[model samples]
Target: MLNRVLAVALAAGLVAGLAIAVLQHFTTTPLILAGEAFEKPAGHASLDPAAGLRFSGATIILAHSHGEGAHDEAGWSPTDGLERTAFTSLATVVTAIGFALILMAGLVLSGDPIDGRRALAWAAAAFIATGLAPALGLAPELPGSAAAPLLARQIWWMGTAVATAAALWLLIRTPGLWAKAAGLLLLLAPHVIGAPRPEVYASGAPAELAGAFAATSLVVNAALWASVAVAVGFFWQRFKPHAS
Candidate 1:
């Protein structure tokens, strides 16, 4: 069981990560670069591509520190072309694998039968819990966008994800009406509490451009999760005979 789970996760993560990286390279990457144009001051150095799809916070785009040219002064980052692409792909793959492991563990715990169709449902739930739910309160932002403190945002994001996941499990897996009612409350609790926010809304990027980036990021992340499901489903079926 352990070996089968790891194998499926590895394969799914690779496929999803590569797919997302390619999509982002053409889509979100350009938007991020354009947003950075607004972020750079008269003489400040450019920020790195490290702001996208990190495993941390379940966010497609992360908030970048814009004050004092902190992006440049913080530490070494991959340069603009192939190096950045390589780093992004690596980070994405690692993040995908982490997510995959979580999904696989849930499957194990649930003891549910696995297939492409079923896995697709699971992936959609995962996307909602980890991506869309939190995004409702905290949309993806470009580097120059104003944001609350990172730690606070992280805490809220995690809470939202956990709440959403538990709610989903209750709604889908449990049968009682009480379970459904509890699920509904859990689903709404995070949004009711609200996400952390900056006192003032500000950004170096234009409103139009930032909106575009947020929408594009959500699309890319959706594709990533879907791809993971397809890959996991494929691998799980393929390896079933050998799983024991």
Candidate 2:
């Protein structure tokens, strides 16, 4: 069963990740490059070395928003064009694989028969938890955007995702009014606590461009999640007997 699950998830992740990478190259990449133009002029002081440019699977979720002082040559980054695309694609595929694994785990935990439709439902829920929930507080940001400290924002992001996931599970899996009420409160607690924010909400990017980038990023991420769902669902269905 474990082997079957891994097989399904790996295949699904590769397909979805490659698809998303292509979609992002066309959609979000242009916006990012445009935003970079608005970033601080080349001479600005570089920030922490640890936070330097890193192209990794977590980049999509953790650091999509490039903040001030984050674009120094002190750190290595994939050059624009083919190299950048290759790294981005690789990172996205790995990220998608992780997501697929988590989704499969959820199915296993629920002990429900997995199929494309069911996998999609799970993916939708996952999106709401990992994507939309945190985004409520921290909309997708662009290069040159004002942001709170990276560590603070990361802590909040992870908390929001976990809290939202737990709240969702409680709301959907448990019965009773109290449980439902608690779940609702849990869902709202993170927002109520508030997301970390910069002292000043400033950005070098034009307001219109920033807005467009945020919207586009969200849409692209949604597509990625949906793609993962479809792929995973198809593969799971194909290996249902082994999975069970």
Candidate 3:
């Protein structure tokens, strides 16, 4: 049974991760390349290394208002060539598979017979636990973006992920109002403590590009998580014991 569960999860992850990588090539990767262009001009490489940039509402509005250009993603560059695409695909697959296994374990702990439907729910929870929640404090950074102290960000990021995961597990699996309330508190605790922020914010990338990247990255992650969950769920259900 354990082997079967793992097999199903691995299959699901393989497919979803490939899909995400393809989507990212067209979506986030272009933005990433464009952001890199600004790196040299901004004197960012030699400047502050500990000031991570984040997307503000303004940058997204700017990106939407403009159309394609050099900074806005014009003709494809050699940077977005086959090699990069292949590497990205490989990395994404590994990441997705890891998450799928985590989700499977969570389902087991839920005391529910793993099924497609529950797998989907667990995926959603996992996303919240690992991605979106933690991102509340640390929006994805583009290359050359300033970052907070490495140690600080790492601590907060890990703590938030763990707290969020625990909260979700309690909320979903534990019975009773008190249990649910506890979950809600855990969910809020990390945020209350706040994510570590850079002493200052700076970026080589234009705000418009940075904003677009952050927004797109979040969207990409959302798709990746959902696809992995559904795929994992489907395969898990297919492998489960039939009604007898």
Candidate 4:
């Protein structure tokens, strides 16, 4: 039983980590790269062309022309190199493991029949608290340097919500290969769609950073859904009565 629980926890954690890494790689990394690329050319023109070459090695360069100024009031900054990427990835994995263990323990304790609607309601509340709440404050504040195209960001968020909801609904309500496939698709959708791209760059910054925010939200929601699944599975197992 302990082995099984450990296996489930590890699997859930791995999946969650992979999903986050892929999303970040496709979404946030590109924005950072774009910011870097833009900074090179913009800085070159604003400063000595030769001096701009010196800035190439710098992972993040903050340049503000007389009028360009800083991005929105938000103090968000672009992620640097592999250090930030690795840190983010590690954080995702750790969070996933913690969530899986907690949910598994909760489900084992509850020992009640799975209630799809109740599960969904709980999932939705978790989604709002974990996914949307931080976004409300963090989204707008993301440094303008990482700003992505508005339409693309909107599509990413809408798709993420729909995919995540569908994945969770199916995973808990149905038990079949189809549900698994749906969940996989939900996990891969952001990468398939190609995360939002930068629309414009000024002073080495994108106009908006919503794509990164949306991607982060998606990752959080994915972990929540995974927790729901582990919880539901544990509940069903614990509550099943043995033959007399």
What TM-score does candidate 2 reach?
0.85
**Residue 50 C-alpha lDDT in model 2:** 59
Query: Over 4 Å off in model 1, which ranges?
Result: 40-72, 242-244
lDDT of 3 by residue, 24-133 (tens): 88999888777765453233233233543323312221221233465455344333478668887899999989878887887786687676677777777877877899
- Considering summed lDDT, which 10 consecutive residues are worst modelled in model 2? 56-65
| Regions of candidate 2 where Cα sits further than 4 Å from its true position | 41-72, 240-244
Question: By how many angstroms RMSD does model 4 differ from the true structure?
Answer: 11.6
Model 1: clashing residue pairs?
none
Clashing pairs in 3: 50-147, 51-146, 51-147, 52-146, 52-147
Q: Where does the lowest 10-residue lDDT sum fall in candidate 3?
A: 57-66
> What is the C-alpha lDDT profile of model 1 across 165-244, one tens digit per residue?
99999999999999999999999999999999998776757789999999999988888888888888888988786434
- Quote the lDDT for 34 in model 4: 52
* Candidate 4, 1-244: lDDT as tens digits: 5665666666666666667666767765566555444454433434344544244454334442222333443254334567667877887777766666655554445563444444445545446434663344235323334457667677676766566556665666568998888877765565566556555545434445445545655664655565555554554455455779
Q: Judged by lDDT relative to the true structure, which candidate is superior, 2 or 3? A: 2
